[model samples]
Target: MRGLMGRTAICILIILFAATAVAAAQTGDDAVTEGNITEIYSTIDTCDITLTSSSTIEDLVIDVQLVHEDRIIDRETLNVDRINANSRTIKVIRWNVKTSEDGAYKVLVQLLNNEEEIASKEYGFVHGRQVIPEVVIEGTIANSEGVTAVIRPVKATLVDIDYMLVDGTDVIYLAKDEKISIHTTPLTVHKRWNTLLLNNREYTGLVKVRPSDEVNAIVVTDSFSSMDDAKITDVYKDEIGASATIEGGSQVPFDGYVRFTVYDHDGENVVESVIMRSPILLTGDDETVEAIWENRLREGKYRLVIEIIGNDGDVLDIQETMIDVEKSVTISNDITEVVEENNSSPSFLITQAVLVLAAVGFVLRRRNIR
Candidate 1:
């Protein structure tokens, strides 16, 4: 009786194993190929899911759930008519939460075919407070035709920028809806105003930066004057002196001098400095002024900084040029100048001839007396 009972138990266990194998064969080898969850904003989350199948599936249903601390915060269901064999499908899901506090969250997803579970996936994320961007206008630079606003962002942020050039109460130029990404570094944005179109006067520059998450925009205002009417048009240099031609524009008269400063090849040592006073320049007038450094330069390289200074000691324009001295002028030019001076003086020649005749007569008279 004991041997018969043991055989019956063995038969029952074999039958159960056969049933489990048959169920697995019918389900097919479908799987969740990829899945991820990311917090895009403070309260917005996106889930990306990919499903792949080895065999065709009919009436596919995808169930997605967002859970926090064992509680279902949100649930979404997706339906697809069919998925071909040896193919994959992609689905995107988004969830908006009411809180922005830091917390652990999960995206639970399940893929089913005809009420049979085929694949499942879970993605976890920790939501944290989003960083709001902040920026400040460091300064403004003005040129003859344009203005540049220097901005420094405190953090990485997306922002809209606006620039305006104002003349007294009138808006002369305006730029709006300029979008840019700013990092933790200085950024310069330039806008052309063509200050030559307007009279020489003081103008106000305005810059506005608006962050996406902020309600109010940050504003910065600075004053910059239109370029002075006087500008250096031509530069001429030699070993002894540097000369520049100053041209006057249509607006104002220019009464300035040119200051020439000489520096070593590396611009580290000051060699010499001189100033050449220029006549008052009227509109549409150009004049050349030269500054002689006196000390001739050797055969080498040097840097010349020329500044157009007004009568009021205001610098109107500045320029820089590199001078390569090929030949030394001290020996050759000085000797030539001395010979020319002696030859050009008629009085010195006549006096030397008279002294020669007088010496010859004295020698003859002394010999005759002996």
Candidate 2:
């Protein structure tokens, strides 16, 4: 009998709990009221409150008040005529403080229907009369040395600039904590970046400037490509050596070398080869590198291959051409024949001996006569 009584009591409690939840849910769905402050944009001079209403409201008014030291400092009122039923109406109320004082303050935003308060929100702010700077990027130029971003700041501020691909995929470079004191003209910020480290294909440059007082950074983007290149422009060959003219593109600065390889007419046997150091190749500069062969080749037609190699030991370009050697070279057999002919000249030696004998005889005869 006791267990049956307890079971009956438990059933009654379960039914009562379920009925209470249903009543609460129904009350939430049928409630008619003005919505809360959805957004607030506060600056030193003004504060904007964005408010919304769910049900039909008429003769609505928005009150934005600034308070300090538990006292009302300033107030601004805006009137909204009406908001329809079964719909939503949102409005932004801009409140101008008209004060430049620096201190902590409270901002109260209220929505009213004919002097009756419907919804209210309070926000805290520390105003210093500092204007949030408007930053704009004019353009960006890229090269092997780095990327330069032209930016115009409307107000003076300290900012850091970062660069990356337009897709936000990777960071290319960063320049931090640059003070922009001039607001009248555009300034250039350069970040060291080697474009050769990236692909040769086209890419978009992205610059993000973050001011010291702002929470979010401003971004600008531009399209660009890697301008780093080294080309073998011209090649010249002489009797003793060969020289190549190398022109570097405007993006990156580097040092390079020239390698000259001389092969037989068949291009199978390397007859002579040499490697020579090149001058420092700067942006858009032309440098000439020369290589002298260690061994002289026989007079014949040969294949010449010239390679332009960078300081990093990477070959930048290769050029091949045929060279005809027409030098007047004296061989060992001709030298030996000339020596033999000079040694066998008996007539000349006989004339030299006769002249010496005549001189000796005349000297002896003069001595006897004396």
Candidate 3:
């Protein structure tokens, strides 16, 4: 009876231990609330993953595996200790996974407690390759009315750009394999004055052309004498049927004079004349001089040469300018006439006076005849 009792007690103890083990396995020693795979690479045979758990655990183990078909290509495991409670723990497990393999992969990570899986995670992976090219534009030109000038073009290359062109105030995008043409129109006199802009870096030039017809005549005004010193201050010219005001020296009015000359395209002298004039008269510290001229001019292209004359009859400054003469408009005739009935003029006061005098004369004649 004693041996039987001992046997029963041993059997009860074994049953209790098996039940406790089953309960512990069901509850799981560590719970993986979150698991994440951060980065994956195509060329390199590696991946990075992060793991988080609810409570601190000991002997924490992570496994990385790549399953291909029914075979496992690589497997790795790492041990982590004292993972903090409700905190993330990072474990880097290097595996022999081949990136060149043209197949799908599965990464499996497991947290083990006493050689038993308490939490597990799985993810998918892929491997391949790709690339891209670049392009850009380098320069531009302006052309109009058979005349062309180099305008600054875009300076870029195909390290990243596909192709480019400038339109209005924007850079337009083009295909990788495309040709580009850039051009601008010349400025009109009615629109903008003549000017030139150059791009020094790109060795490009832009010309602004103004509309003009022909030069007509050259007129020079009389020289003016300064108050302090007899120096010329300003000069005047009657050009293209209009007067042009020219500036002279600041101090001397009589010391400055202007010479006007006009030449045609064949180099023949058209108008050769000189006028010494001071347009501004500065007296008592006042800095101003006035010059005026009036002359009739014809319509033609002409070159105007202006020379400033010193008091000693020496030329001080000279400038040559081109002028174009435009046609002028003229009104011809005017007439005033009145159409009247019965030979009467169209005047109310004259007609009323005539009627009043006729009535008075008739009354007088009737009284005389009686």
Candidate 4:
């Protein structure tokens, strides 16, 4: 009876193993419910399709067909794996098809479950054989004097090329694959300078021409002070002379010198005047003062002018002053007095008169030599 019980237990274990295998197989099986094409390419032979399944699937077989007017033109088959059950996933399929005919075609994608159509999706595809061109131009723009205006890029394509300028009413036609460069002019109207302007038509933020090079100008301002205020009493020949503080202007240090133009109101030309040289010094607030003026000045009323210049063709500032010049003078005199109280010969007196007349003639001749 014990042997009979052991054989029955072995038979029961075999039936349970078979039942577990059957359940596992059912759970792993999958079926597709819907399929649809997502995208169709005109240049490249490619199409994307989305497929939905009814259950969790590990593998799937897809077939793609291209049809024109109910006639099959191309057909391809693809195998995919690791797809989720009851979920939608995108599958991309590539195929070689003749696109010489400019017409519409239909794409049919089918998901197969055990060699049976479980899901299908359709899409429309069109092909056109045309060449499109694009054009781009990049450069700098300046005014007539080569001053910077604006830098910009001009782009044009054949598809959409109609544009109007911001300040003018001119219609610009940008051809396909065509690039152009235009130098914009600075507009001055009503005494107001407009840096940028439109063409014939009004378009906001039109192409602006900016200066690519640097710009420079000259600025002049004048000031005056006395040497007494400058605390300069004596001036040497070789050394730099007095200095008068210049104020109320914008000046840059290490630029050009402040030329001291001294003019004598009593003289005819500039040669009768004197000029002083000065080195630049740093001051506050964009102002520079120089102790470069020469101290050697003659006694007279003179005019002083200072000018500031830059290396980049820009004049920053200028100054002018009128000063009274005074110099020290020295004089030496010798005098002899004679008294005729003692007795003297008459002939001696006559000789002395003759000698005096001869001396006067000699002095006159020396004056003529000069």
Candidate 5:
């Protein structure tokens, strides 16, 4: 009876083993298995997932996805109609590692047939090498007449930008909804400064960029502030100098300089010119500056012109007046200079007589010596 009972127990154990084996086979024990992930480097990273299956799958569509630190990077799909049974296959995938943060990654390979998943597997791998993107931003640049800015990328970003202008200096500012309106004449660089505005704050800089209208327009309009509203009330002439009044009007503050130009007779000759500025002024404020000719005036004619310049060095208003200096001096082009002598004065005759006497004495002395 003991021997019979032992045989029955052995048969029951074999039956359980067979049932477990059958269940394993039906649940894709013969299906695709997770394989190794190899990273090949050449400009970018190409990951190949090695998979093998013991059962054939028809109309196969294989997908290999790359994920870095639980974040999906990219996916590659292939149409491999029929995969033979007991075959090892490699699915290729490409991804940019430099664009992603440095961390551990996992590559998942999945096989599909008849729109149904046949087998799915995942293999985790750490990506150490960084593959930078070939191009971050690429575009074309064009400009209209008179420095109209042309920028394609509005949301693009740049770091450590240095810029300057003809009147102002280097400036840096955040490019956010920043409308760059450039209206300028052909002006040259005058001075340079080291102040900049980054993310709405000002800082000092050492790097220098071209002060072209395109760049400086943005910096000057945003980083710096200027309000130009002035009136030049026809320049007037004084005894030996010319003066003009630049009155800030229009209820706007003026924050620039005043330029004065005094011409000689015709408007072509620039006799005296000067630039004066009070820096800051409010509405209805006025400042007067004079450009004086230190020497006594020669008299004939003169013209005085005064101009109000904006912070960008643009001429706001120009007022010119012609003044006739009525004096005793007369000049001619042929004769360099001519001074009218007093005919009734006795000093002229006395000078002529003395000159004649000196000439006669010299002649007499030469003859006596001979």
Candidate 6:
């Protein structure tokens, strides 16, 4: 009779647990407890995405994102292991303090239940100031058309300019500082002010310009040609590095530079590089230049990419080649033998004789002077 009573008690407990889970499911009281970043001196940069639930929720995804103004500085999405009923949990994400551009930033944390956003909150706070890139407006020139500012950047960034046309205390604000993102070239940013402003009164101008980190310029060139068709001849290795003879011809005479870049067998990362500049080939000239890599690379397969760049930043020719580098005792022995042969060669003997003669002549001249 005691065994039967024990079995009945177990069944009753299971039913009660099911009923409790059903009731909890009907009342999904889940909320994001904290989405705002906790305030601290700029030393620590951490954001907590905390949530509380009245019932256990499985596989709930939480996405925490922090943005400085419109730019997303950091974002983290996580699938919560599980949240216990009537319990709270917190997930933490690290913030790169470098992204905080010396001012208050807004943060967003959203809790999603089965792909539906159930809870979300936004937070904002101010951070200490930092040295950021800016546009330097040295001076301005004005005419009846518009005003132009002599602008240069203090950092690699983009700058926007606003101008005011003033004619004898008649201040006419033309264009506000319109932010322009640059990613074409790191060359100096100079925009001419020629846009027509309202009111035809001729006026002198003053300008204000601002720089932003989001805007940057990238160096690009179409004239610099990759050595795609370059033929690799006589590729060998000695004490210096991997050496190769690059053979190609150019149809147009150009002032340019040649570069040889080598990558590992994967051809993803550069392992060695060599560049030569000036006195390039003439028109319709077949060119041959020796490219010697100085990096001490281990014995392995490597990919070599050669590029010819014109003075105007254009690619002229490009080619790819594969090589296997090896360091062997036999190679060293062969090199020594070749050196010995070269030292005893007729041309080498003639060079030594000339040097000895020159030294003797110098000594005789000194004796006569004495």
Q: Report the C-alpha lDDT of model 5 over 221-292, residue by residue, as the tens digit.
A: 112222345677646575466676777542234677777677887678877676777445444567776666
- Whole-model Cα lDDT of every candidate shown, in order: 0.67, 0.66, 0.41, 0.41, 0.48, 0.53
What are the candidates' C-alpha RMSDs? Answer: 22.3, 20.5, 29.8, 27.0, 25.9, 22.3
Candidate 5 residues lying further than 4 Å off, grouped into runs, are: 1-226, 250-252, 328-370
Candidate 3 residue-wise lDDT, 24-136, digit = tens: 87665423342322332211244444556565567766666767665777877766665565665444333565455665667766666678776676766544323111111
- Number of the top TM-score candidate: 2
**lDDT at residue 98 of model 3 (Cα atoms):** 43
lDDT of 2 by residue, 279-307 (tens): 76655679888777776656788899998
Instruction: Output candidate 2 Cα RMSD.
Output: 20.5
lDDT of 1 by residue, 1-370 (tens): 9999999999999999998888776543224322212111112354445555555666878788888889888887877566556665555454666764577777788777677766676766666545443877788765435567787888777788766666553345666655688887888887665333444577766566777666445656667655445789999886778789998753334666889999999999989899888776655578989888778887788999999887567887999998777642222355445546789788876776676668668756643442
Model 6 regions more than 4 Å off: 1-44, 129-370
Q: Which candidate, 5 or 6, would have the higher lDDT against the true structure?
A: 6
lDDT per residue, candidate 6, 151-221, as tens digits?
Answer: 55565555665444433322323355556654433323322233333222333444444465433221110
TM-score of 6: 0.25
Flag regions of model 2 displaced more than 4 Å. Answer: 1-228, 327-370
- Estimate the TM-score for candidate 1: 0.32
Predicted structure 5: clash tally: 0
Give the better candidate number (4 or 6) by lDDT.
6
Best by lDDT: 1
Q: Could you tell me every candidate's TM-score relative to the true structure?
A: 0.32, 0.34, 0.26, 0.26, 0.28, 0.25
Arranged by lDDT with the best first, the candidates are: 1, 2, 6, 5, 3, 4
